[model samples]
Target chain A: MDIVVCIKQVPDTSEVSIDPETNTLVREGVPSIINPYDENAIEVGLQLKEEHGGTVTALSMGPPQAEEALRQALAMGCDEAILISDRAFAGSDTLATSYVLAEAIRKVDSYDLIICGKQAFDGDTAQVGPGIAEQLGIPQATYAVDVKVDENRIAVKRLLAGSFETIEMKLPALITADKHMNVPRHAGLRGVMAARKKEIPTWTLEDIEADPEKCGLSGSPTTVVEIFPPQRSHKTERLEGEAQQVARQLVEKLREAQLL
Target chain B: MNIYIDAEKCTGCQLCVKACPYSAIQMAEGLATITEACTLCGGCVSVCPVDAIIWEAPAVEEVDTSDYQGVWVIGEVGEDGLAGVTWELLGKGRELAEDLNTELSLVVLGDEAGELAQKAAQSGPDRVFYAEDPALACYRTGTYTDVISGLINKHKPEIVLFGATEQGRDLAPRIAVRIKTGLTADCTGLEIDPEERLLVQTRPAFGGNIMARIITRNHRPQMATVRPRVMQRLQSQPEHGAEIVEVPVSFNETSIMTRIIDIAHDEAAGQVNLQDAEIIVSGGRGLKKPENFAIIRELADALGAVVGASRPTVDDGWIAPYHQVGQTGSTVQPRLYIACGISGAVQHLAGMSGADCIVAINSDPAAPIFEVAHYGIVGDVFEVVPALTEIVREELGSG
Candidate 1:
């Protein structure tokens, strides 16, 4: 019943803003937090640990600064934390990132299940989780809103368009956590101090035996050629009146637009 | 490829120099100049009003792109029949195919897909592929990917498109990984390069703050999953039948990694009609809490519209996820979109901004939602919603 939760630190997407004058991201004062969805992933792992009496480990692949994110995971009831960071992996895309993570998981070598957030807030790409499952030749269920675990298999309630489909898979399968899987627990003082006592392990690409060519920008099949703010040219006709009067005007406008 | 300036068209605007985040653009003698440090992010191209910047990349190692043929869309099952996004993709996909001088094809995979395949072809695909097995009835990541990847290997379609729905999002990436291809997700715009015959995918990046135009260089059978409702559907339903091909797949249900036990629906069924609704009323985190959503519901009822929620409200369990209208939720292009207490996060804006008339009601006049709104009311939702609802009710009663 051992579990590994793959997590990432991302710019708090809500606060991240673009400078109007520069037309570039004003990343200076933005805070980095464990991706909003990954907190649910961490919560799901801890819940499984509490129910099944197994150890939960948090894994992340990012810069050295991401180690803080792992410490936060430890404070949230994980037994151990591992940070996989290397200069070679700086520009890694989903495929390359999954490769390093899969290799690291093989190195950990004791897990029955792996969990990842549905998607990172910044990239908003739900590729790496399935990519890891594909790389490791295991089954994966993405966008799981609820999960129940036992010694042999895991049952998941996956979020679809309008309904929740209950799915079951054997051990060693991967599940991507969706929002509201569980309310992530806030770390208390005792847990925060205990987290400091735990030694965090750092792994380099070479430590995982990752192929150099397939580990970073060189291996990524896609590249970003152009990125610019969405050009929005909208002019609104403001309605200024008491609420009731404004509401009447809205109906009149809709009538004028032939929408009614 | 080298970046250059068209001096004739240059208006001596230095905006590009300031727009370059990398300091790659310098103002040289009152004209913008590109430095060697330029990453070619196309920042200057967007800022240039006179179209003065020329960022050119010559056709590199032209290996007859014509070898790639046929535009393909994966189909999904909906309540009555095929999903709306499936039809939307087919409609948009047909344009891409024609631009490339190729045929538009479709593949429907499910437990029982023979009928679904025919339904897919009714959308005007040149050929329809039914890769059916009982195992596909509910999506198991492994089996679905293998079957579609196998079809891809055999048929070798040049371009493949999918809906950014729950099923398509889950299946498309797995297929892309298995077949060793690149996939762009949540695309809002798609076009084919007439000369190089590459799929040009335009999608929001960095949480909709920026629009990224991505191309997978040297990848065969370019793949993209377009968001629902962003594309225009065909005016007429398919009057003629299309060619159908049944793709053979060998699989045992037990061999797949996952099995679906049951599907449970959330309670917001009747109110969650954001996709097809001609008029929609949506609320956001500004509703304060789940109970306050009653204001949104009341407004929707008075207008005879379906109720939609933003991502935050749904994530907070105030409403069902299906009722959400945003980047991660259903992209609705309703004729009239009334947003209450919505500050309009970029993701939310990307979803519903395409509506014919967007009315935003937020107490904060500075909210970004006002930028795209056709009508902005700076008033409290508590006050505005009730007043609006009563007036609408009275207006309708008078009518």
Candidate 2:
């Protein structure tokens, strides 16, 4: 019943400033935090560990500063934390990202279930969880709203298009959890103190035995040729007059626009 | 170039085969196998129900245009003839055209849309190739793709851009497959690399966790669908007139498969689509109960804004899926986004972070929603939401 929760430290999107000149996100002073979704994954892992009597390991791949995210996971009651930081991993797309993460998981070995947030807030692709499952050739249940672990199988309520589908998969499976899965617990003073002295393992590409070509931008099948902010036009037609009149005029305007 | 198929997960659904339109997928040994004729249009990936199919193109090194050429955008016409997104894409197409140093053109279709050609001209396109047949009035994917593909084969634009609306979503993939070209969807950003003459399509991936840059280096008329409001609309300058070229559409009834039963226009179709709503007030599980959303409804009503909710609230039957905003739900870009009692988890933020201004009201100061809010009010939303609604009502009245 050993569980591994994968987390990422993302730029605090709120504090992210867009450079108007370059139309790119300015990450200079923006603080990074554990991707909010990963917090739930960690909470789920810790709860499962408490109930099942197994160790929970927190894993992340980012720069050196990403150790903070792993440490935060430890403070939240995770038994162990691992950080896989390497400069070469930068600029990897979802395909390459999943490759590296899957390789990292293989290196960990003997994990029963791997949990990740449904998607990261920054990328919005919702591809990594499934992509990782694909790379590992494991059963993946995505957009999982609820989980019920039994003797040898895990029953999950998966979110599909406009409906819920209950699915059952064997152990050593991957599940991407949604926010509705559970509310994450806060780190108390005792856990915080314990986390400070916990041994946080650091792994690199060589340590993980990953193919350098398949683990980063080189392995990535996609490349972003450009990154720029969207341009907005301010041509709002304010409908005036009485409420009913305005509504009528608005409908008429839509008709005129052939939008109705 | 390596196409990976999870056969264990593949249901052999034939959706990819049917969606291919090009018959690129065939049943081989009772499994769906992609042949060399497979155009890599990604039409199959979108239609796969079990999410079993994944096709990855070769790693992008440089733009290779050994096969085809030309830059074309499908000139989408609203009933009245002008679509704001069509204009925005022209601005984008203009940029891509200049980068490739090629002629920028648009394929205009529909009845009496030729008059709209005047508006398309202002976007600085080199030409407006149109089909004014009465049969092309309403958007039929089969017909539109046939007409557009016919024009593409004739002119051969190296790049093609479509507004990722309902019409474009249906039409673009079909045309891409017909032409054996590549198509990217919901692109938030687009750019041309001057050196290689490549159209780099940038979009959020992994539910907004990372941005994936995609390109159709080998495919001719590298196609991408730009989301509406994700790009700036160009001003209509009548002075920048385009060369009006009339392209004849000869798609007979035999080629058309799906017929339009009826064109029931949605009441909210033409107005600010919810995804494009500038001001959104969202409710979530922390709101305590469903009834409390009336406060949210009133606030949204007063502000003339749209209301959204987290998956929990929607799952609890408190709101419809349309009102749910997140990674699994709708993406929004409102001017002002106010989250009431939401904990601000990553999934919820993925949908609303694009807003210009964010205001969060939650009792927990440590709530993740507060971290992203430009303005934070730490208090019970029951009291705070009502008070804020009243204040806005009074302020707007006075103003």
Candidate 3:
């Protein structure tokens, strides 16, 4: 089996804050880390390779700095790493991103399975995995919590709104890892040392035989007309007192508001 | 798609640098230079005081959007019946339909679509397109995408709405890619652009730190997926009769690539119905331990409310993912929401901010959660949560 795990570098949104005066994101000095869920994706791919006796490749599409995320995946045990980055791929949304990723996977030539995190932290669209599957004309199982391979078929336990469903698909299918999939392992000293010397080649549109028109904002159909901070519509009444007193006051307010 | 900064017009005031969320712009040698990090989000285009940054759009064939007509919603069916989000979309779709002066239709696909269609028609759709087949019963991505995309190509509806459920999220993008159209996901606000006559889609991004208003000007059918509780549903009109159009379904089952083996509902059974709950009590990282969730459950049980968890709590394995209340979790609009220990991250706010009444309890006085909360108690969760639960239990028991 040959598994390809897709990952992304994202700003740790927890640490991202807004400037009160300017009402815009204060992105300066924010740390970039691998998207939290993508670690589970890398772990899933590594475990599959361990059990199935196959090679695992880590792939990513982002700016040049995204190579750090691929190196992190390598530190976790991926055999190879590839970064698909180019000026032409800028401003690409999920649809265009999936197209470029599908093209890159096609260039990778042979693969039994493709895995991705359920969604990117920044975008949170959860569209690219299925989009890639659709563009590749293959099957997809999203939000997979567990995956088992049997000869030529794979069974995936997918997480639904509040339930779990088990589904089976053939080889050369796509799977998106849910957070419940597995515990991601940190890079050990030896693993980090090995990954430091690994060569990661960057791929551009021409390298992947991708159409320049279908690469970036030109290929993206959706346009952002306006961007602003979320509106704070509530005027909170703070109850200042001891814990017990505040609790009682809250109950009274709830009763007065008929919410109790 | 080239974006460049004209050096002649540059003032190097660095306004664009502060405006860019991606940090793609930097002042190098007294001029704002674009880097590989630029997503061309156009953040710099409007913020440039000197209008030095230029975005060159690629020329493409203009789409004949004039030919498209009517507003359509793809209805979904759950284990019990039509999902609440289906009704919510219909309720909103009716308004969009009225805005466009077009008919609103609900497309129902299932093995027993005929019965579901009858049940759905009373919900205020002008018409219901019932596409029934065994192959259509379970939502296989390929089968549903093929059928819906085919119908879209044939009908050419002006606008299409989908519930941003797991199934809808899984299916919408594939259909969009197949038909080469645009789709906006998890839109909280949808309206008709008065001047351009386009669907203006507004959604939260960067974990609710920012909101973007999106538009698909050139696409024939404007598509968007809305979260379940984001939109309200119109009441069913018993007197309103709808025309039912039977769609012929012809797809090879053997050609389908994936098969459903089994489905196991939540072991807690029916407890995960946060979407329709009237009240919810959610806990966050303040609990400090997984076992500490008992107080949250106690409070929820006392109030007959459902249990919800913040993303951090769920991510830390303190609770199941289904109990998560945030952008990545379920968006809920309950009558009253009690958030304990949750400092109100923007992502968590995106989910439960719509509650009729929000009461936040955290030790921190300046936690961001209080900004949108209707009531705030600056106290420890361990102390405040148990007290609240005790009072609620006594009050409800006596009442």
Candidate 4:
């Protein structure tokens, strides 16, 4: 099995904060890390490779800085890394991103399986994986927590809002990894050194033979017309007292407000 | 499509760099440069005081949309008949359709599609299109996409709406790609652009830190998956009649690439649908230990509320991921939400902030959760949760 795990570098949204004064996101000093789910996807790929005996390749589409994320994937035991970056790819939505990625996966060719994070933390669309599968004309199982390969088929245990469903699909399919898939392992020193020395090629839109029209904002159907801070209520009624007293007061307030 | 900086108007204030959510703009040689990281969100365009950052939007090929009419909502069927989200979508779909002076239609696909569609017609859609087959019952991506996309291609609805549930998120994008159209995800707001007759979609990005209003320009059947619980469901009216259309599902079963092996519905794990719950009591890392979640459970029991968990708690194995309330987990809009020990991260807030009333209890007085909670108690969860449970048990006579 040749596994290709798609990854993305995202700003640590947990550390991101808004400036109360300017009402804008304080992006300064915020660190960018490999999306959490992508890390799990890489782990799934590596584990599958170990069990089934195949090479694992980590792929990402972002600026040059995103190569750092791919290197981390390699350090975590990926056999190879590839970065698909191009200026024309800027302003791409999930659809365009999937198109470019699907094209790149086609170029990778002869792959048995493709894995992607359930969704990027920042975008949280959860569309790219399925979109890529559709563009590739393959089957996909999203929010997969466990996957087991058997010969030419794989069974995926997927998570839903209130249930877990196991879906079986043929090879050369796509599966989006959920956070519960597996605990990701940290990169070892030897692996890090080897990854640093390894050559990871960067592919552009032209290299993937993607239609320029479907590569970026041009291919994107949705456009952001406005951006603003989410409105938040500042007024909070504090119940200042002992725990017992506060609890009583809360109950009383709830009763008075007809919320109890 | 051209994005360039006007050298004459550039003052290199670097505001765009700070304003950019993606950090796509940078100062190089005292002039701001747009990097490949830019998603063309046009965030920097507005922050530039000199208007030096110019974004020439790409020309969209003209599509004759006059042939496309009616607003169609993809109704979902869950373990319980028609999902509440279907009614919610119909409620909002009615408004949009009314605004556009078009008909509102509901498309349901399942083994009981006819029954579900009939049940949904009470919500007052002008039309209901249903495709029935056992193969369409369990929501295989291939069959669902084929059937819906086939219907969409045939009917040419001007706009399509879907609930941003797991099934919707999985099926909408595939259908959109198959039909060669754009589909926005998890929109919190949807409205019709009166002049252009476009769907204006507003959704949170960057984990609810910012809101982006999006539009599918020049695309027919402007499609978007709306967040559940955000839209209100209209009262069912028996007097309302709908034109029912039966769709024939045609697809090769052998051509389907996936099969459902088993569906294990863990009642203990996700028995309580957080989105549908009226009250939710959520625990966080501040609960101190995994075992301490019992206190939250007790409180939820006393109040007849569902138990929810913050991401940290779920990630720490203190609770199941199904109990998680946050951006990456579930976006819920219950009537009352009680947060215990949760520090109120933006991710968590993105989910339950829509609750009608919020009560937060934390030992730390400065926790961000207090900022959004309508009622705040600066006390330990161990102390406050049990006390509140006792008081509520007595007050509500639920003990």
What ordering of candidates by lDDT runs from best to worst? 4, 3, 1, 2
DockQ of predicted model 4: 0.73
Off by over 4 Å in 3: A242-245, A255-258, B6-10, B268-276, B288-291, B311-322, B327-333
Candidate 1 per-residue lDDT over residues A26-48, each given as its tens digit: 55546778987889899999988
On the 0 to 100 scale, the lDDT of residue A81 in model 2 is 92
* After superposition, candidate 1 runs with Cα above 4 Å error: A18-24, B1-66, B235-241, B268-278, B284-292, B308-335, B345-356, B380-383, B394-399
Clashing pairs in 4: A91-B39
- Candidate 2 Cα lDDT to native: 0.69
Fnat of candidate 2? 0.10
Candidate rank order under TM-score: 4, 3, 1, 2
Q: Which tens-of-lDDT digit does each residue in B1-399 have in candidate 4? A: 368888889998989888887787888989998876776778777778888988998888988988899999998887788888988998999899999999999999988888988777765899999999988878999998988898999999999999998999999999988887888899999998899988899998888888889988877778999988889895677889898999977666777899999999869656767867889999999989999999999999998999999998888788877888987677788888999999988779878888889999999998989888999999888888999999888878895
Better of 1 and 4 by DockQ: 4
Candidate 2 lDDT tens digits, B250-299: 65754344333333333433232467576788898878888888999888
Candidate 2 lDDT over A1-260, as tens digits, reads 89989998765665554443554444444566788778878888887888778889889987676788899999999988999867566545555677788889998857989999866755544556655665665566666667778886787775432345565677777888876577799999999999999988888888888888775556554444433234433322332344334334433443354332
TM-score of chain A of 3: 0.96
lDDT of 3 by residue, B1-399 (tens): 478999999999988887777788899999999987988888678777778989876665689998999999998898777888899999999999999889999999989999999888876999999899998888888888988999999999989999888999999999989988889998989999777889999987887778889888787688999977778787888999899899998877678898899988876625867877889999999999999999999999999999999988887889987788876677788999999999988678867887899999998988988888899988889999998888888888931
Taking the true A–B contacts (Cα pairs closer than 8 Å), what share appears in each candidate? Answer: 0.60, 0.10, 0.78, 0.83
Interface DockQ of each model: 0.39, 0.05, 0.68, 0.73
Clashes of 4: 1
Best-performing candidate as measured by lDDT: 4
> For model 1, how does the per-residue alpha-carbon lDDT over B1-399 read when each residue is reduced to its tens digit?
246899788878776775654456677787777765454446567778888998754333333545667988888777777788888888898888878777888888887799887766665888899977877776667777887888888888888888887777787877877776678888988887777667788987666777888887766678888888788774445485789999888787567677778888855643475767889999998889899999888888888888888887887789876788876666677889999988888678767877888999998988988888998999888888888888788878631
User: Where is model 4 chain B poorest over a 10-residue stretch in terms of lDDT?
Assistant: B266-275
